[model samples]
Target: MTKLTRTLALSIFALAAGTAGAMPRPMDAGRVIMSDTADRDVAIDTSTRWVNVTNGQTVRFDVGGQRFTFVFDAWPSTDSVPLSAIAPKGVTVPDVRVYIAPNPLYQD
Candidate 1:
């Protein structure tokens, strides 16, 4: 192959590699915050607003002078559900702080 053709092919390959690395991975169904309950520490992924909790886990959020507690059952667990599904009607997920306790919540 001509030197010019080889150089152009290599340049295209390098560009594709760089762009692929720059592209962000699709956010998880939601973000997982491990709430040990001792330390009010919070872990969040700014990309998604969904929150997931497991059984025996408690998640609380205060909004508009009201507090909401979500208690999951031991079984029939909700693997992943949008924060809006549990939050008070008309409450936007982005406006609320999602807290999830340590449990069997899986991460991919």
Candidate 2:
């Protein structure tokens, strides 16, 4: 191939790769609320619209007019561990979990 053709092809390839690796712009505030209240490490992946937390990383959130806390326990198999929360009675919790595909969301 000619040098010009090769350069154009390389440029296109690089642009495509960059676009593929680019992360989506998160439309919401996303963060991992880590609470070390025990010997656990929780990593809450809320960008996916679910509170998928890991061991020990607990996310504290406020729903309605009350506050709620989600805790992830360490147990068998450590792949994609889920999290749970304790909510007060008669309160509606919003879906605070947000998953911006292509990459994990972050807050500034």
Candidate 3:
């Protein structure tokens, strides 16, 4: 191939690759609630939400007027509490467990 044609083809390929890499992925939608170290009760009427609880933090969720408290068992690491954790206690929603974590299958 000629020098100019080769340069144009390479530029197009680079642009296409960059565009593909920049494409956005579908993300799950939910409310994120962060708690402090002190133990306290939080009222959450919403059916869907994610709670990030730190070590020594106890969060009580009042779902649908019923109270359900979950204490962080692991120390020194924050725990990702999905809606299912509180569902068995009192929270009403579709019976499903959704655990969100770093995608191990992801590639840079």
Candidate 4:
């Protein structure tokens, strides 16, 4: 194989292997909620739409230029929550579902 071709193959292999970690799914506001799964397509980018949180922990994520913090008071929930539950009184977040950590499959 040519040197450039071999390097390109290796780079592609490395990129695929590195992104095998679980990624959260995205949902539009007012849309029906679907079961959360890590085996989603690579094309969908939900990086900013979700937040991973731990038991009794607080997680903060940004949408646009604003920051929002969510305290997992109701941790151990099997479902996601709306931004209104965590957002400040007047700031309106986008139509997205926020999920906490402990993705179940990773739990004991």
The candidate that achieves the highest TM-score relative to the unseen native structure: 4
TM-score for each candidate, following the candidate numbering: 0.34, 0.29, 0.39, 0.39
> 107, model 2: CA deviation in Å?
27
| Best model number under lDDT | 4
lDDT (Cα atoms) of all candidates against the true structure: 0.45, 0.41, 0.47, 0.48
The candidate 1 region of ten consecutive residues with least summed lDDT is 23-32
lDDT, residue 95, model 1: 33
Model 2: runs farther than 4 Å from truth?
Answer: 1-48, 74-85, 94-108
lDDT tens readout by residue for model 1, 37-86: 42222233345454445445555544444445555432232244445545
Deviation of model 3 at 83, angstroms: 2.4
* Model 2 quality (TM-score): 0.29
Off by over 4 Å in 1: 1-52, 62-66, 74-77, 95-108
Clashes of each: 0, 12, 0, 1
lDDT of 2 by residue, 1-108 (tens): 999999999999999999984432211122233343432322333343464444444456544334445443333323232122233446454444422122123213
Ranking of models by TM-score: 4, 3, 1, 2
